[model samples]
Target chain A: MMFYIHKAACISPQQTFGDIDIEQLHVAVDNKLYAIEPKYPHFNGNALRRMSKSTRMGAGAALPLLADNDKPNGIIIGTQVSGMEENGKFLNQIIEYNEDMLTPGSFVQGTPNTISSQIALINNNKNYNLTHVHRGLAFENAALDAAMLVNENPAHTYLLGGVDEISANNYTLDTLGGWFKKEPCPSDGLYNSTTAGSLSGEGATMFTVSGNQAGAIAKLSAITTIHSSDVAVVKERIKNFISKELPDGKKIDLLLTGENGDARVFPFYQACEEILDDQTAIARFKHMSGEYPTASSFALWLACNFVGGILNIPRHMIKRHGDLKSLKNILVYNTHKVGQHGCMLVNVA
Target chain B: MDRIVVTGIGVISAIGHSVNENHAALVMGKTGIIKGGGNFPSRYSGLLPFGEVLVSTDELKTKLNVTQPGVTRTTLLALHAFKEAIADAGLSPDELSAHDTALVGATTVGGMCLTDELYANTHGDTENVEYVRSFDYASVNLFIQNRYNITGVVNTMNTACSSSANAIMYGCRLIKNGLASRVIVGGADSLAKFTVNGFNALRILSDEACTPFDQNRKGLNLGEGAAFLVLEKESDATGKKNYACVSGYGNANDAYHPSSLSPEGDGPYLAMKSALESAGLNPADIDFINAHGTGTENNDEVESRAMLNLFGTLPNFASTKGFTGHTLGAASAIEAVYSVLNIDRQELYPNLNFSEPIADIRLQPVMDHRSAAITHVMSNSFGFGGNCTSLVFSKP
Candidate 1:
């Protein structure tokens, strides 16, 4: 389907809320990389205070794209655990209050669709609104749906987003599950090192995808996901996806991957890297955005910048810098876990 | 466009354990709401009525042969319904694991069914935190996908009560767009203290059974269970036992309140209108309607206004929530199965406990278990965050 991304907004661990800050990059000194939230002007005093961090970040990122642009007919937000921290607090309050007369503040905020619904509530755009909460491919699924919606009615526009927050307690518990490094690791060290657990990060990335090519920054060429853990099966699928998405002579300028320095799952990224063109420049984003399920959205934002020539390869992010005068087709391959894999191709306008 | 049809269906609700059992309960006019469930001990357990499943989590685990630890009741309930749905569709392991078979599941309080475990885990102790992995919003679907080795796009939706309806909608899109040939779609949410207490905190839980559309209805009764439907292209389902054709679906947001629908029911109105438009059918052609009647005063009145605004004179309509209570994410799938049964069986279930209709807009519902010329059945599911969805199922 014809899917073109017009605008992008992100709230991540780095200073990437309203715009991409390429001058300097922030590294996570601790294992958990918290999202650097921007002030939400759409929500007033109590409304902002009541919303969860994920919701605030999601609205803070999504509302700006809708401010001075074509209003989208739909909104789809994706997240692995949007209101997780609120759920934890709500449960704790239930215990403290003895399940008695408790207000609906925390309980209502505990729902996972808080972000998408809050965006709808903020903009008062009563269009098609939905939320996807898959483990790793949540953002990809949302984008796929957005593509379908746009194809159905090319005249209409849609807003898509991915958001997840860092729950301190949950991050610590995740270390027990071997999802986070036992000790704090620097951004550069976590990108290339062979560590058991990777860094845990959270972010909210929002953009407008429309069939209207006017003022488009990049075309969402295609999105594919592989649901396998077997090495051969995943490798075959990766190769097939490259050929299917790229085809003949469509060389990739930049290849961004979700490599968070985990030894067990790094092979999946390697399988993807092995199939890329020899001259393709390599880039990674987990060191900056950490290892959240929807972290691919961050990688996608970075790929969009490279496509628009808004950014050059950072020293710490570049593995093999290619000599490309103008970046064109950028591919983002994110294998969040050993079993889950996602690939997307962004064609510059 | 290739027509998407439901080849198989499965359900696990308070009223029944399987499709046949649930159908039997509907025919016999048996209500599943009871004073309290013996399991999950809470202040309202013995006081307020809830449509809790009869099967215990341990029993479900043993019956389903689930050896995986930390598998919450939500996942177990999903496993029960998913097994039945795929089996009813006569899909083999090879077919299930095929590259074109996608699974779309939805849940609201997914893994939070073990609220105590989550609370303890979220506290300081890391020792007994097995459910830490289960806390993912997509935990139920991921567990099912891994257990069944589903290779296609397996996604999970969590748009409050409208979750599974969107899931079914997305599954059909996957087929029409040539992404997946077959899509397994449904949702599951077992009763959780977090949910029950949350709803209770919202003051929307009724002390008595939920009497949808009734003037005297207080609120809704929280329910628990799971339901799934296997959808495939018409060519792929040619020789299969087809239930109903998934004709059309629509989703919209009210943009009014976080948990309440607009006074005019704009979201529900647009959702139903768009569904009809997509199905190439007029509002008058929708013969039966399965309303998202949570028995809440606001919902019944608002839904009545929306339906009246859409179809001047409403057709045979009822809210099966009276029998199943509010299943939240699973409510759509469970009601979708009921919608299929309404089309295939040519009958309509009465809205239980409903006596007098609402005062201003007195929209009478199907109050008796009787046969009807059920052709196009519309199922409505509206949830928190103003997310509303409608799915139309027609007789095959």
Candidate 2:
């Protein structure tokens, strides 16, 4: 079953939230990338005043997909760290007060499903709502779920997205754990570095999906996850998916690979590269968006924009340029924790 | 669409370590909730009651032969239940490692079971990074994926208390969609200062054992556990011992409140109504209901009202949370196992710690273990985010 991405929006560290101007991509702060946000004036209420950075970004991204006051049949979200900033605030409150004087304010909004609930609350929608929290497969799973749900009732629409945040507590611990580069790593030279750690970043990307193809930017052709640490096993999975999805030997015009600049885990990207023909253009987003669990969502946003003919492959994103004929099909390939790999294909609607 | 059936089930909870053990305890009307939780040294250690698992982390690690680093208590409990489930299904190694075999796990806290260590790290009081790998909620299922080498579309659901019920629903969808022939789905959550303090701050955690659906019910008792059910296509599960058929599922959002259901119980009513529609059954077809019944002031009344609104009269309904406490992410899965057991055995387990009927609803629950001509069983789980889900399991 095929589902169309009718309307898509993204709030990221880049200028992609609007019709992105490639010249004004966001730069990192000490290798920590943060999403550029808006005033979110539409969210006006006391309840929304308590929205966290992640929830605000999520709702902001998803709000544009829906017409004013129009609610989808479901809102399924995916995130590795939603409401984490609230969590840290609550925990710090407990520690500072010695677990004595703490309110449920922050704790109440700190669940992994808080983003989905906040969106539902704002719209007053009471249809199916779910949140998937996997390492990197979060968005892919949510997308597939949306597809299945839409297939169940093609007349119904669904809103699902991936949103995550990089809190100081998490970033500090992650940096201490060697997940981020020790020194400043700018977006320009992200993949060129020969370092053990990858750059850290966070953002939110959402879409209003439906079985109908009207006013659609792109069709989500396929989405899957390959969970393994072995390069050979991962390579086999990618190779099989490539062959199956592109059975007629049609080359992907643009392949957005989630290649974080970590030299230690570069071989997995190489494995993905091995499956594609040299004629296929290869571009990685981590160089522009940085690396997070749901970075592939940014890749999806890119794929939709490309197929929608919003822009050409930006010079900054071009790693291995090929004949830029037309944007027919694009693939998003990303790895998480250097073990879990995720892939999604977007075709022109 | 293919029919999804439960081939095997496994669970590890505060009441027992395995499915059979839990069933035995249910038959004996034994409760796992204690006056104080001994697992953690939180401020509420002795002040509030908890359904803490009886087993120790080290003992569980040794028992499960899990030597991996960064494996949190949540993962340990999940692995313990996962082992029992696959074994009960009599799945061979080849079948487990097959491409069509998938796993969907649920958890609210993955590696944050060490809430104190996380706090210590945040304050620069400790230089330890061992808990870093477990910080992502996906770590719970990541450990499982690595252990079982499950390559199929593995995902984790974290919709608060309704997490595993959604996972179970997602598993059935996978089978029906021809994505996978089998999916192992469940959830795990262990008591930690993180959750304990969070709930304590909410002021909804009870000081004594929870009494669900009672007039004087104080609140819910926090619990810990894990449960896994092997959901497979009916053709593939034909030769296996089928426990129950995953007939229908429905998920809805309350939207009225983040942590409280609407006074009208719109979410709960829609969920149950959609589930019955999905199952192609009428209200009379549902023989029993494993209600969400958290014993919280808002939940019990609203859930009861929803039942009355939908069925006009209650079925054989009970909240097993009185026995296992609210396990958060794991509650729905554990209760799902109990629901399937209710149909498979043609018997209903009693709801513990119940005395008087709810004042407003004036409805009584199944208070004694009794045999009945059970057929279809409905299981409900509502989460903190107003995410409500209902699942219907029927005789296979």
Candidate 3:
């Protein structure tokens, strides 16, 4: 009894939806990353101008498909930085005024719950709403919450989403924090560069989750989280949870990884790859989407599309030689530097 | 199915910093609203009196033996609230092994106060990198985890005003699912320019002492506070004194407006109804309600109407915000702690500043604290993004 994904949309570093043009997306190099330019004007005009990056990305990705469904019973948006740009700008204003004065917009955007708040405002479909942040696991935690909610109430559609953006000051600070790779690499050939840190990027992905199997694009068989510093325990738990929760004897067809340029995290993925080996097609996305807490959302998004029969994997994301044509079941694994781990099982319907 | 019960409660609002002080204030009907301090506007911002705690970080440190600095106001409040909760539960540190106790928290701003200060101190001050770590929720988790050596699942939830409610809900779920044995579920937040300006930008901050349910209720006064409750499964509570039973809880989104609730109050309505249904009790079983009543025009009317629609006639209801102002992430936890207090004492806390009734409904909030044999308390917390939640605590 797995929850199914009815409709999924993503505003990422690639052309995700609405006349998705594969060629138009800006590719990157070893140290550079960028957000895919979706038509914001199409979703909203003046409103788009007013939104912080996270708000705009979430609304653009969710509103198109979400508008057609009857008000969702619950809405949950996840983000690592709710409104970084607005916060920075507002602080800039304060610095200019010497802390004597500041405006409300900066503070409004800084609340961390602003993106979900905006989404709720637009849909007017308030039933249950939540905004979860766990540094890098923000999106996974949100998806897990949505799946659990769907399990509790089988009839309603729950929206699980994640959004964040690159800000000048924030990005600069990230670079100082040893977050991004210093060298550059082509977007399609990100892994070939052998870099250390990932380029900064931003995105939003929304999924319509339901318990019903009929008309489901794909079923989410299982989702699990781990917070252990011991890589051995992390590896064992992944194998244990997946084997226990998913149908046995079905080797995964695809493996979606949150493998940023960081070499330290490769051991965990290496452990995973050794388990399935050639049975699963390997793919990594931090080169395209950059590394953020909720970047796992993009991996899940790509898995959903693959399950939905898109059959197209971004050229820059391939990490191993496996036939994509035979993809049926996809396993997405992601981790943060602080040792938060998450895994989700996606199936072809 | 397992039942979730509240075994311990702790709070630090404007009235007092401990459970005893808060109970005394509630019973005596003493208000905590006062003029703002430091850079905050004292009385001119249409200030409704708030139930604000009267302690600075220095005072908190002196009392709690905390040595950390450059932390956010939110963390300070959280430490105070959690210490009381653990003590009230009689959960001695020596009684359990490390990782047996888990810390689950919710906050709108993890360390915005520190962030604000850092931004101001552009003079190249080499402050501890560990202090800035509080800028995110994990930092808060790390703080408590390291202090108590809690190795269990440590997580944070942020969904506007409903953040802590979700934290509480998740804590209960984790225990129900057998993920952990003992968990601290609650949140803490303090007033900062970020939130004060944010609410002001939305035109929701009250210019005077807030009057929730009043016909002229304009908006809510921002407040500072923290609250926590120890949720233990029945098996874990074999030797413990329980405060209240976590009868039911539900969360819903209005999907209406991000900043304002639905005009019909459908989200709040459904959340309350669902919570009632989950508890296997009818609305009539509710003896009192701790309303979210932020004194905002939209919240009071919509929440009041939703309550009226659910219960027909409003039960004994009041907004503690009229006393403490709104504590944002900590609001629900503060109110939850208050609800436990009222039930434990068999008394009802008054909704201060409630003078006139709104035209939308005939419901009136208790203007003065009342004493009665209370059994069940329904608490509501609605936040931006149409995030609404209702929690029911039944007397043990």
lDDT (10s digit) by residue, model 3, range A140-245: 7788777777777898788889877877655655554456666655555555546565667888888888998888888888877777667787888888877887
Ranking by DockQ: 2, 1, 3
The residue pairs that clash in candidate 1, if any, are none
- lDDT by residue (B201-284, candidate 1, tens digit) is 888889998999999999999999999999999888878998999999999898898888899999999999989988999999
Off by over 4 Å in 3: A21-25, A29-32, A98-103, A182-196, A271-281, A322-325, B36-52, B58-70, B90-103, B118-132, B145-153, B175-182, B202-208, B215-218, B356-363
- Put down candidate 2 lDDT per residue, A1-349, tens digits, no spaces: 5689888899988887766676556778788778888777787777567888889899899887866777999999989868888989987887788788788888878888989998898889999999988968888888889989888888888997988888878787777777789877777778789987888888999988898888888998887788778899889988888788764856788788988888868899998888877878998788666777778888898888899887677778888988767778898899976887888888998
Between candidates 1 and 2, the one scoring higher on lDDT is 1
User: TM-score: which is higher, 2 or 3?
Assistant: 2
Off by over 4 Å in 2: A45-48, A247-249
- Candidate 3 Cα RMSD after full superposition onto the native fold (Å): 3.6
Q: For each candidate, give its TM-score against the true structure.
A: 0.98, 0.98, 0.89
Error of 3 at A149 (Å): 1.6
For every prediction, compared with the true complex, DockQ reads 0.75, 0.76, 0.40
Q: For candidate 2, write residues B194-270 as lDDT tens digits.
A: 78788887888888889999999999999999999998888877688988999999899999887889999998999
